[model samples]
Target: MKFSTAAIMAFPAALLLAWQAAAAPGQGPDAETRAWWTITEALSNDRMEGRDTGSAGYDRAAQLVADKFKAAGLKPLGDKGSWFQPVAMNEIAIERAGIGVGDRPLVFLQDITVDPSNAMPVTVDAPLAYRGYCGAAALGDVRGKIVICHGVNRPGLPGAAERIAAVKAAGGIGLATIADPGFAIEPPRWPFAYARSVTLANASPDTDGFLRLRLKADALKKAIGDHGPDAGDLIAKGSAGEPLPGFDIRESFHATFTVKRRQITSSNVIGLLPGSDPASTDQAIVLSAHLDGYGFGTPVNGDGLYNGTLDDAAYVALLIRVAEQRRGKGYRRPVIFAAFTGEEKGLLGSTWFVAHPTLPRTSIAANINLDQLRPIFPLDLLTVHALDDTSLGDDVRAVANGMNIAVQHDPEPARNLLRRSDQWPFLQAGIPATAFVFGYRPGTESERIYRQWYRTGYHTPLDDPHQHIDWKAAADFNRFFKTLVERVADQEAAPAWKAGSSLRPAGH
Candidate 1:
């Protein structure tokens, strides 16, 4: 069959429209559902290239989000009458990496993972010291030496990052940490060559070190060779919450790394829906979701695009649906919809937004952010992050109860999800904030589905829109989200921090 260029170009949209129409009798999902589907399909399309921050694909996704905001009657709340608030960053990629001891070459991505931010050809040949959990006393004689450390031994112990900083301050030349069992290296998601690292240009350090890498446990053990406790023994003790005494390991590690750095700009897409009530219009509610995902990288299953269908594309779609549904409506306070960029790169966009807010900083009342909430199963339970930290938890419970859905606190605190998403920036700025994840009790079918999704697709190219999702569950959450926003916006006063709440930053 022969087809014209126009016909080929029109196929996807026409097919999607047909699917929408076929789902109903000559009418499709109401405007809200159609709105959600259209935005999700457009953003997740292969052509968008997974919306990696600072890439052309990310620019296209940002534009799409801005257009949706404009079409939904949202007031542009970005810089100088623009929908884009520019964020400056530096992108770093590893060009060369190798580690060796004596004449033995330790494999990359197997025996070790290097810090790509290290200056090219970072030749480090230094003495080695084993600093267990890096207490102030443990950091002795770190000058000009490579420091090996156990990962966190308990929740309150100094973590790997903290230990690295201390070692660097004490003049350590290199840092390597044993993989924390769940670190990115052991199961190796992408190949070693696919390094796409980014850091904020404003926060760039004046000096760089052979920062840190994940050293394979067995490989480290072989290197120590009875000079110190075995790597596996240290890890087992750390994993079991036991502390170990610091000692010197009799070995010197050598490594060289090459990296390429480039300055780039990405943006956060912000829009505002002004409230109807004169009294409350001064304060606003913010809804946020990230628009960036891992772009093209080392191919997995011969696919390199990390199309974040659920990781964020879905929730960004939800934000659009809510904005479209609430246009010209009667909420008492304004609502700000922010599609953040560089979330995968340490919540850069939201951090920048909070630091340089378009609105008066104190006037922003609360933030309800969304990241990846897999709706693969029914929507019977919702897990609210930082639920006990502020009054926003009460609001979530009230809204979920009205919808007949049970609300729960973060069930897995060890994941430290509370401090991981875009919402954390708002909370840090002393604004009441929280985020949601679909909840599942242990050993249930819902738990099974959630775990399987995480194990298989969480950050991979496999998270594309072609994967399974319960559309009805999405619609249900959309309804619940809309009601929550409306109620919070219409409340008599701005959401408040509970007295004595640990999250209430000093003088907030």
Candidate 2:
């Protein structure tokens, strides 16, 4: 049951509708879920080619969204009064690379991965230093070495930025952070399709000759063979965030890289549904989801396309469903629908949009972002990011409660998921915002399914339409999203930040 772009594009309208309706009896999606699945299937089918930013496939998906918006009676609210806002970006990818420690060669994207940067050297042979956690105090005399640090994400542990700065301050040439295996809430994923980076076109690229690398946890021992402290003990202590002594490894590091760079132009799809009331019409409530994915990448289990069905294609479809349900009606406040690009490239699309909004920036009242919302299992509980930072949390909690769904604040804040999506950009701009994840108690079947998805499907070729889905859960969340939107849009006052929240920006 695979579909290709050419075959789908060649089908007549009636034939296509018939094909869509030919699902097996009793196995078909529920009526409530059918429309949502239809849109998702269209966007995520093989023809779209994973919808990578600035690619032809992304353009096709964007056009489909724009057509849907027009049919739903939404007005163009993008740049130059069109349904598209062009975003210029610079894309960099590692065309080829190899790394080794002493005589042991490490497999690229398997044993280790290098973060692509223009500043990375084509070849390097430097001494290695093991600085536990790479904390400032532990980074002593790492000058000209490739520093190794434990990648711990919990509080009190020096995070990536802190470790990188400390290494640079100690005159280190590169840093390799071992992927922590102890973080069970969200474990590190391996075999990245490729190493790439996309940044705003006008932004300055990293010019310093400092390399960033992520070594697979299991590879740490092999990388340090008989050179320093017992690798097993170091991993155990580092995973626990326990202090360990820093030492220079006797092994030297060597690597060569072939990098490619290109200029790309991706667009954000924007549409507006005006408000019924004149007074509140100026203040818009934004609904957003990223439309970019990894596109074609290194093959996994013989599949190369990263369809991104649940990662975000499904939610983008959910947005279209919302617009269709409105059917030309306006809420009390204007609603802006934003289908963003370059989210996988570090939230570049949303960041650009926030900096250069089509409408006045001050007119944005709030943002209800849709990303990382996996309803693969039952929709019994939801983990809400920024749940306590703004009144938007209250709105969502009330809505979920009325629907018999439990809502909890992000239980694993150390994942920093709160700042990983489009919502964070809105939050940074002083607009109330939040996102969600389907929650499960530890040791539940739902938890297993969630973790399995993260391990096999997340950012992989397995994230396609063929994957198992809880249709009932999907419908339940769709209803919840629509209800929450109406409740916030029709409310008299705009959502506000809660007092004493650290996330709150100055001046309201």
Candidate 3:
């Protein structure tokens, strides 16, 4: 049909609209993040692309935190007693990584790639010995040889002190897993690729060479056995076992890598509650929580943004409430409230803050750290990390007893979650700290009404206020912490780290 000038203009607009619709799913504003996000609205919006350490977004976030501290009436820890405490850091990303078996070049990610959890860069020219699994037996001197291990072995193998004799005897340089190598074969017969994950937690290779691989255990077993014990070896020594011919490494090779590392500056936003007593003000109790998240690429349904609402946003809000409550009550000792950044990046903000404090770091008494506190109900039990070594434990027991709440150690120690939050900074700096979280796992007896609300909304973009949270439960926890902090702040006694802890840093 012949169209008029008006119709012609509409066509371009219509095409543009269609293009937008087509790209909607994969490309759009991060809706889920926008929903669950509770970061400072100003900062999260202005720097929503993510506050990457080196990006302008980070600066915006810095300002928001500083403003919060200022509004809260806390003294600044910056150079001239300002709010910021700077830290140095360096960020790096992997450019290229490959493996080699003799002259065959191993493919990337699918075939073999180093795990960054416990990442290191290096070059090697040596034969490989598949140690089967990197259990305790895989230890020892693996000075110049490649030692093959399963992904599970990198964490300490049970009884590892004795088991790694083989690695020690052979002088191996590193140990790794080759479970599923870089790619896969489909019916059409082309290979597809997938990357591997690694961590320093389980990566216990004695030598410096660090890497991870994807492989089928039983299949690799047959191939290595058939080709001699060196069949699937990436570094080329003879791997023993039946060589499974159809199983292909596709690619495996190694080259020298120049690792660049650096430390960049970061900060912590803090406010305070001046005590009624001058002496007591010097000895303070810390109230803190991490103020950071996955930043981006965080899964919020289809949105790649991490809205850390219950992840600690709620805790931040609670902290504000507690501060408001204490402001009404006239504290006897200083109450230091810190909203720390760099928690997702490795607890750098708190670490730096404790190193350079606003008041006498030595006088600082204890820390009450709030995290992932989307309470579904008044928790019947309370969780504590590092509770064994300090007077804070006594305080917790007393307070929990008073509230009739069972005080328990971290139920999920496997996650190492106790040491995983912002509190670890204060703990490492000689302050006793406690972090609180609540949830009922699959098939549990918790009939608490808030359980259902917590189930679906914990970490997603849906964790907005609408996600059924027991505000009453949140209130109870707030009251519990407020009472706990009030008692500590009023007490003249100092809260200290348990003796024998490797964590107590000097001058803390």
**Each model's TM-score?**
0.83, 0.92, 0.65
lDDT of 3 by residue, 1-508 (tens): 3435344334432242243234323322143223223433444442444454433455566666666656655566565667665555544344455455655555443344444432554565565555544443434444565666543322333223333444555565454454422211100110111122211222244443334334443334432444554444532221222122222222233444444444455556677767778767667878887665544543433554544555555565556556544443557877777877677666667776777676788778788888856565446677777667677878877887897777776655544677778788777766778776654433443432233333234333444333434444555576678778877777767676666755566664
Q: lDDT at 54 for candidate 3?
A: 35
lDDT tens digits, residue span 1-508, model 2: 8566457546543344345336312355687699899899899999999999999999999999999999999999999999999999998898888889999989999889988887788898999988889999888898899999999987888998999999999899999999998886777877778899889998987787789999998888878988678999999898988888888878899999888999999999999999999999767999999998889988876788999988799999999999998998999999999999999999999999999999999899999999998767789999998889988899998999999999998888788899999999999988999889999998886786677567666898878887777777888899999999999999998888999999888987
Off by over 4 Å in 3: 1-55, 95-119, 122-129, 136-148, 151-156, 159-170, 177-263, 298-302, 325-330, 372-378, 439-472, 496-508
Q: Which ten residues in a row have the lowest lDDT in candidate 3?
A: 183-192
The TM-score of predicted model 2 comes to 0.92
Instruction: Please give the range of 10 consecutive residues that has the lowest summed lDDT in model 1.
Output: 184-193
TM-score quality measure for candidate 3:
0.65
Clashing pairs in 1: none
> Please, what are the lDDT tens digits per residue for candidate 1 over residues 347-446?
9999999999988987898999988588777799999887888877888889899888998877776567888899999998999998898888877857
CA-lDDT, candidates in order: 0.77, 0.88, 0.53
Please identify which of the two predictions, 1 or 2, would achieve the higher lDDT against the true structure.
Answer: 2
